[model samples]
Target: MPAQPDLRSSEPQRGGLSATQQALDAQTALLPYALAVFTVSLPAYVWAGSHAPNAVWMSATFAIFAAAWAAFYGAVNWLKKPEAATDLKMRGRVQIFCALIWALAVGQIAFFADGAGAAREPLLLTAVAAAVVVIFFASPWLPSLLIVGPAAAAGPLIALFAQPETRELASLSWGAIALSMALALIFNRVLRRQFEMAAERETLIADRAGMVEAARRLAQSKSDLVATLSHEIRNGLTGVAHVLAAAAGRNGRGAPSREQLSAALDAANDLISVLNTTLDSETAEAGRLSVEARPFDAVNLLRDLVLLNRPNATAKGLELALHVSDDLASAKTGAALADAHRARQILANLIGNAVKFTVRGRVEARIEQTLSGRIAIEIADTGPGLAAEEMERAFEPFLRVERTSAGTSGAGLGLSLSRQLARLMGGDLTAHSAVGVGSCFRLELPYDPEATAEREVVQAEVSTTPDPADRKALRVLIAEDDGLNAAMLRAVLEQLGHHVVHAVDGRRAFELAKAIEFDLIMIDGRMPNMDGPQTIAAIRALTGHGGQPPIIAVIGGDAEEAMDCTAAGADAVLRKPVSVGAVARAVADAISAGRSEPENRVVA
Candidate 1:
């Protein structure tokens, strides 16, 4: 026969009660029914004792049975408390203990009734009924039933079988008791299965609801992001278009004033800043954001950011000030070994936000070296500040403060991306704000004195070299799929005095490279018909002087993509939104490096 599942089993189970917990619940339900049986049994015992030969002993036995039932009831009530409810082992032991007591008390009563012979049949029937009730309740947990069931039934059978006339009656009673216990076991199994099913159903419902809620939240977040981007982009482009139209005399204006030009530049820069921040946030989330740590002049970078932000501040009628600590002022160099690009990005965001929000009073930028030899920059503004709750969520991506007016435009990624960059560079960014009292943001970075001296020495050595502008004009090849981008690059190269050859794709650029030995090659990282890296690799595989020219990869991705371009034999990597000066310098550097290498050799 297959082994019966142990009703006493207590191994943990998910989405439903464990075996022990089920057993505890069974015992708890049985308590009230057991109490009623004991209450009625007391009166029957007293009446039987009055008509018995050993009446005094029977009465005393009845009193002890009452006391045991009282103790059992107390234990069950105690288990209802929060602390004691989970003690499954203790609860099981208590049920076993009570079962033993019940068996002894009822068995003795049945024996005494059979001996009295006055109310013999009636009392024996009552004892059997009481035992059957307990067996029904205790069946859910087999340990209790195993001891109590047989013992409760055995006492009456023995008493009746002792008399020759009652033996037939006892045989019939035995069959009924066996049938009752069987039914109880079957009922317990069916009920427990139902309970488990209910528990599982509840769990499934909860999980589905949670998934729906998460999907709803994500959809709402994306909608808000789209709305913010559209608003900011439209406003910025409108300002730039208006200024340019005026400058061209198309709007009946002779020439653009200095203020108009500055406003236009600021508007265009704002659009770029918003786009970069959005890209950085996505890159960071994908774990592809790279930090290139190097030594740079922190003091100079902060001064430039403050100077750039002053025009915006003055236009808003807000005072802007830059403060340097005595130590930093005397040293004249706040050198930090970190990601210079990301540091500039963080400080610019902080300063820009300070100026943009402060309608009156002043915006201040403070630079200092902490006692632990770390560089610290704090941007404070006298703006309509944020409340405690709003400040807490300031660094959350895509979160815009409700205090921002309709005129103020942003994509809500500046603070979030800035903080991520700070931590990536082995530093931190923090903020302090109070409603109506203004706000302050602090950025901290690692400092290195040796890097400062090294930078200064390199600067002095470079000062003695010939200017890149004095170099002779050279042939430059430009590979870009976008027409406007190619035109802009061609214009910049021509203005720099280099003869430029334009290719709409990498295939054309490769063909041009094979036919003509160019002094430099600038290719886009991504293009149709042949990507930048693939073209560069193919060019490098060519024979003779076809592959020897210096190659520069123009990318619009994070540092990981830049590394990919360089791996394919490119000499340098330049990111998109390139300026005239940046292009001129890249051209000069590539040409200078190419001249130093052998003609028939390829760079790898």
Candidate 2:
């Protein structure tokens, strides 16, 4: 059996009871004392009035007992005060005071009964009973026991011993005293146990409440995760649909030119990037995302972002402008240590949003170095700007701001992911906007010129010749399970002037590949009968005539897929929502690499 947790440890040591319980305890503790005063005072006043050495002594004794009762009443009132309720010391003092007053009343009764002889027995018995009641009520309090215990035991003896004929009553009085003391100890134990049990119960209740609150938060987090995934996946599907429709010439429009098809492909790729960024944000929230800092030129990065979005701005009849500080432009090295990819992602999101939301006016990007050697990039747009209240909420995932212009709306993860990426790189993204004006997003990143080092530059030969419209077409094989994706792939390949053969599953594709000699084979990562990696392995193991055709694995935009495809003997990997340009590049690169190797030979 598992060991149980000690709940007593969780209970507060001082005043742990709720207000109602404390009030009840206070009343119970004071009740017995009040009753004892009444029980003893009435008899004392009668005795003094009937049998007194003098009227003056009788009046004085009666007056003293009355005053003691009044003082006890005042102490009870003091304990009842709201300020005194939580004061443990004050409560202890009040209990002690009550005990003392009780002791005094018992002592006084014994004094008056001493001279009354046999008549004093009833008075002494009454005093003993009152002491027992007070001790019983006060047992819950430790201080009360310390003061009242001895007084209760000794009060009866005062009257018994003071009598000259206490010989017969002495034994009986001692037994009563012993019995009262025993009851006090027993009741004290019981009361202490009660308090401990109550405290334990309170502790368990508090723990249960905490667990409930935690469970609620976890459920809410799960809900948010589902919402984010649904929104982003829908956006990705929309991008895929737009690109495919354009490739198939099904938009009730003329055939899309190569540039338009390329733009659509770029849009699809951007959607994939957004999904990857969302994953990055999740990793960041879990504290697992790490930054890869290296030396990079900030000027070149900003220039690229401006150029990339310039088309979008122009298409919308909006001016795109860039302003770079002279100092930054003229810096000898112009290098900064940062995560260049993440920085680009943040800027892309900001610039993309600016272009998407704006209609007629210009979008301007400004770059400069701060006094503290930090780089600040600001993108200002004349879009229907965000309202003041919408500014902060804009960064919350799945929260989309309503715009006046009927432009495309997103999953609202872009800004949130961008801000998280910026902060992870030891930078921050902030925004300033007004209702009718415009919005400006500022990105601030640490810039360390002192740590800047010389970076190696590699240049590639540029090709200015236009692509030929009548290149040699090759036989291409495609294995995909998704119907829409297969159709899209076929459309792209045919548009590239290639003869295409489609297989619904990898098993059929492998069989067809063995029968026919094809120039290229494309396999989807997830397909019926066999996955892309398994199919690649099977194809590589096959005995072929003209060597195995160059194989390309089409997969989701994930690092794991790329690694798996490479490990499985694929020549190249293409991320899905495949475009004509990507397919052409993959084929050209694979065939070029194949030409350098012997025919009918697997490299591995």
Candidate 3:
């Protein structure tokens, strides 16, 4: 039976290939050289034997040589296999065995030829030629040369040394063997060096290709980002500007109806969401994303998102429903300690995605508490689901699964950012889907039983909605760069019965604050002459009572901008695309916080 190849010879070397493996490759590449030599030499030996005096012995030697060559050929073919070729030790053994067989065939001719004087020169020359050929064949693996080199020369050297008259021929053969072995070692080094250089060149080429592909992908990503943002922002702003123009009677039209305003609000909110998601993704990539964790009713938040997304679902002719687990509903508390705003954001994204993708079937939002005290929300949709590969790619930033006809609208950041926000709050977001069935996205958050119990009691005592009329109207000062934004702020504040004073920039606002005692100061983060933080710092530096009013920073950038405002001693921060309720809440919170911590200041 053929010997099985050694499967556990050694570990792989650099580039995931071993020296033995490389040598095997060289051996396979050089096999044709051996075959060519054998093809020519066997016929030449047969023709030479026809004229020799001891033609019988010559015929026997030729038979031995031919048989040895045939056996070597078979072994070389077997070694061409993937498993057998890499075994350096096995190939070395085969080399020694084949060399011994050829040595024996040559020794028969050297020892038993008829005329010693006539054969001495030719026999010595034959030994030298065999040694050279063996050296060439064994050069791929150095260990094989150690035995094959000596074996090829041993027979001729012994036969010549046995005759007293031909000691000189033996010395000549010995010198030839020594030179051939030395040259074999050098040739082996050259062969290995050439192989290494080729491997390195291939590796460098591969690396260059990889880098080029990565750069191309990056450029494509940038282009896609620019195109998506341009389309979404233009559409959103067009809706908002049209609504505002109609409401202000700029087109000589009556006041816009409630539904038109709501549509505009939705467009503006969608635009804000895209911007916020992009910022959040960047912050998360920088490892600086944070969450403001507090106790809130997660079930109620989910229900609110369902209601918020119902319009979109209805427009798509899809049924949207919310399901609460029996345990959670009976307990009357599905509270969680996390960033409530972030929770709302994540649910809104999931629900929005479900509604957008589902063509005609239903979208369901299910909330339940697990036995391990974790809250899980599942957003399942009867949409054309994603395959395994697509599902995996769905959470990659800037990637969108657009297998449906619902045109890709908005930046592809919803799932990626939602997952980041989920994990930041000690939770995770995952999905399960089949290609034609549907998709279900699960969002899990760490649950606090104590928070749930506390939330139930608090919910019973405190109303989630606050009345703006219950508080005393404030003298508010607004520092805004845009005239339209300033007008909107003034209108919202005045409707809540607050006296409004508007300044075009931070410098003018600062002058007004020094002249009059305002109840609250609302400052936009970016303005000419002075930014939000600079103005806040300058105001807080005042020695008189002018800087004592509650100051709110209206940030339109990222969390870093809010941090800057906080560091500059702002009482509170209000993000842009703000609503009337948000403004009123910010005002009330700033006043309450100012009264509680009048000397609170963060050094910048």
Best by TM-score: 1
Estimate the overall C-alpha local distance difference test score of candidate 2.
0.70
Once superposed on the true structure, which residue ranges of model 1 sit more than 4 Å away at CA?
1-200, 247-255, 282-344, 358-384, 396-399, 402-406, 420-428, 443-472, 558-560, 581-604
Question: How far is 276's C-alpha from truth in model 2 (Å)?
Answer: 9.7
User: Model 3 — which ten-residue stretch has the worst lDDT?
Assistant: 454-463
Error of 2 at 46 (Å): 12
Q: Distance from true position, residue 90, model 3, in Å?
A: 10
Q: Which of candidates 2 and 3 reaches a greater TM-score?
A: 3
C-alpha lDDT (0 to 100) for residue 533 of candidate 2 = 86
TM-score of 1: 0.67
- Clash counts for the predictions, in order: 0, 1, 0
Q: Which model, 1 or 3, shows the larger TM-score? A: 1
Best by lDDT: 1
**Candidate 2 or 3, higher lDDT?**
3
Model 2 Cα lDDT, one tens digit per residue, 246-273: 6687997776678767766566665666
Error of 1 at 460 (Å): 19
Rank candidates by TM-score, best first: 1, 3, 2
lDDT of 3 by residue, 31-54 (tens): 668667756765554554455567
Candidate 1 residues 270-297, lDDT tens each? Answer: 7877887787887886678888787788
Q: How do all models score by TM-score? A: 0.67, 0.54, 0.65
